[model samples]
Target: MGREQEELWDAETAREYDTPGTGMFAPEVLGPTVERLAALADGGAALEFAIGTGRVAVPLARRGVPVTGIDLSRPMIDRLRAKADGATIPVVVGDMATATAPGTFRLVYLVFNTIANLLTQDAQVACFRNAARHLTPGGRFVIELWVPELRKLPPGRQAVVCRVETGYIGLDTYDTLHQHVVSHHFTFGAGRDARLFRTPHRYIWPAELDLMARLAGFALESRHADWNGTEFTAESPSHVSVYRLPHDG
Candidate 1:
């Protein structure tokens, strides 16, 4: 993980992460992701990379799938431990790119664009390699990522407003040449002042991600627009991709 990302997700941020009830922790958001991951586990152990606050891990564990997690943020893991027992869902507090836990897993996953947080192509490739290293033969790796919305930016424009709501606003600025983006988020509530947060990411295309998987000795098994297995079309804004190691590996 980048130094900037490490500092961005501090104790305070971890405390307020799930309160918004938007995005990942929303009422209806986590169900499909957990369901899909559980199915992918196929009665085997699962590992989560960058598993902040156990958003998916806790529920997936509840579904009878053994789950482990690795994260860079101590506070995030603290929050997770507060919700779930350490023995039920063990977590390693370290960078996901190189963190290791005991034993291999049948399924390894990174969700909610966490791969972009690596901030460099080399680091991203290292992450793929790390995932492959931790998997048993024929085990799968999954990623959920947003497709770059470059079309939304008119010619010569460098920024776009992605969301505007009653109490929150979101924007993203792009660096086309470097394939980097910084997302700016602002949230406010009645009688409360607005708080702003910024996170940097290096966006990647699907083909580029496939190459990384190949270099890591994995093959693309499936790609979907969502967790329900919807076919990935050109118009899809995001994707859920599954990759698998060779059976003989």
Candidate 2:
């Protein structure tokens, strides 16, 4: 997260973060995801990594689950606190990669595409290590991230679309020979209101993610295409990976 980007993601903006597209994150997804996690936890407290705006935490709490959230953005947590149900959550303002909270949990959750913010293998892997430190033996860490870079065009060519309301439409062109991926984020609001945010990310494959989990002392336990326990496959569109720590975790 860049300094400028951080400012944009500050409290005021975060308060309306999900207002633009609230339907994208369905209770359908949240419901099943928490149900599976609850079963795995057998009714224990769960820790949410990068629990932005308490989207998942608030609902899970409503379901009678105990959850603690950690986030790097005070603005995000502040917005979360403004919610009627959000105040029930105990949120710590700190980096998810190294922040420590009060106690060990049976479940740790990192939802949405937040992992992309790490932007590096080492940083991403460090997130796993941090989760391990907070989990009890046989505790589970759940993660949800996009499948991979999607093809804007069938061919290797990249497509550029004009900014529209809601958000920008664009793609970062990657040069495989250079081993880098450029992120092109287009922001579209009202008329003639458009902005673009671009950054680079080191994309990782499933096998690489599994390897990182192993390095962090976690073993891959289950993989799902969605929160509903759909089979993970090439066409699944997203991933839900569950990793477990030993009894000594």
Candidate 3:
């Protein structure tokens, strides 16, 4: 993990993580993600990279797919342990790019743009290789990532406001030359001063990701615009991609 990433998701962030109720924990949002992952598990075990707060893993475990997780934040994993038995859905507290958990799995997945958190191309490629190391031959590795919307930036503009709401604002500034972005989030409440959080990410294109998978000994199996299996087109905002290792390997 990058130094910026290590300090960004601190204990305070972990405590306030699910409070917004608009992220991975939201039913309307998490349902389809879990459903897609469960289906891919094929009654075998699944491993989640960056499984924070058990948001998807808990429900996926309830669906009867054995699930384990690896995350960098102990506070985040502590929160997850509050929601699940330690033995039922074990978690390793370390960088997902290199962390190892017991046993192999039929499916290894990273979702909700977690791969971007690595903040470097080399780290991201190592993450793909790590995912491959944990999968059984012919097993699948899935990733859900946002397609970079660089077009939204006007000429000479490096920043874009992606969201504005009653009490919150979200903005991103891009380093186009390096394919890096830093997200700034501000939230306000009555009688309280606004709070700000920033996280860095290295955005990746679909073609580049496929190349990383190839370097890691996996082949592109499928790509979709969403979890429901919509076709990926030029205008899609995000994608769900699946890769597979050769069965003969």
Candidate 4:
């Protein structure tokens, strides 16, 4: 994250970031995520990239796997600290691509398409290398990202509406030439005007992600449609990918 990103995810954004008991916060949605990450942690410490507001980190910590995080936004980390002690759930405030945290870990994971937030090929690649540098031998790096919807975009169309729920809307505009997409979120409530938040991302194919992992001294361990290990098919909208470093290297 940088100046622009920090501004986009500022205090107001952090305040509204959590949607408890519904949407992403629903037990059904978050439980599976925490369960999978806990299993991946394998009784060792875990490192989270861009640990926003401690949503998954908190529950994962409750599962008894020690957790550390690196993030660029102090405001988001502040929100997390409000929920859990900085000493108990340590966080280093810096860019996930280059920030260093103490000690090695059994797992390094980035969820909610945070890897796409790097917004460039080189930065995303560097993120992979960073995760590798922070992991012990044979440790795993996990990422959850949406598969690009390029196939649905007709000729000359640049944007698509991804979600349209009551009082909320999500849209994405693509720039295929640059491998970029901007996510636009609209939120509305009673007696209030709708608010919009936009984030830019660099869309990546699974093959390219694999290549980046390989470049960073990792091999593809597994990929699935979601946390429960659903088989990933061509039509799947998103994927949870696991990559591993060589034990001997």
Query: Best TM-score goes to which candidate?
Result: 4
Model 1: residues >4 Å from true position, as ranges? 20-22, 189-193
Model 2 regions lying over 4 Å from their true place: 1-5, 84-87, 150-192, 195-202
Q: How many clashing pairs in candidate 2?
A: 2
Misplaced by over 4 Å in model 3 are: 190-192
- Which lDDT tens digits does candidate 3 get at residues 11-127? 888998875357556677888988999999988999999999888899999999999999998888888889898899999888999999999999999998999998889999999
lDDT of 4: 0.94
Compute each candidate's TM-score over C-alphas.
Answer: 0.95, 0.83, 0.95, 0.97
Give Cα distance to truth, residue 111, candidate 1, Å.
Answer: 0.7
- Candidate 1, residue 112: the lDDT equals 91
lDDT on C-alpha atoms for all candidate structures: 0.93, 0.75, 0.92, 0.94
Better of 1 and 4 by lDDT: 4
Question: Could you tally the backbone clashes for each prediction?
Answer: 0, 2, 0, 0
Model 2, 1-249: lDDT tens digits are 446436656765676567522454566666786677677666899999888887777777777778899887778887778763444788877778788988889999888767667766777898899999999989898888765554443466654342334555757565545334666777676778766666565555678889999999999999988888889987776788999988752
Tens digits of per-residue lDDT for model 4 on 1-249?
Answer: 678888977898899899889878999989999999999888899999999999999999999989999988888999999889987899998999999999999999999999999988999999999999999999999999999999989999999999999888999999999999999999899867998889999999999999999999999999999998899999999999999999973
After superposing all C-alphas onto the true structure, candidate 3 shows an RMSD in angstroms of: 1.6
In model 2, what is the error at residue 88, expressed in angstroms? 2.7
Q: Which ten residues in a row have the lowest lDDT in candidate 4?
A: 1-10
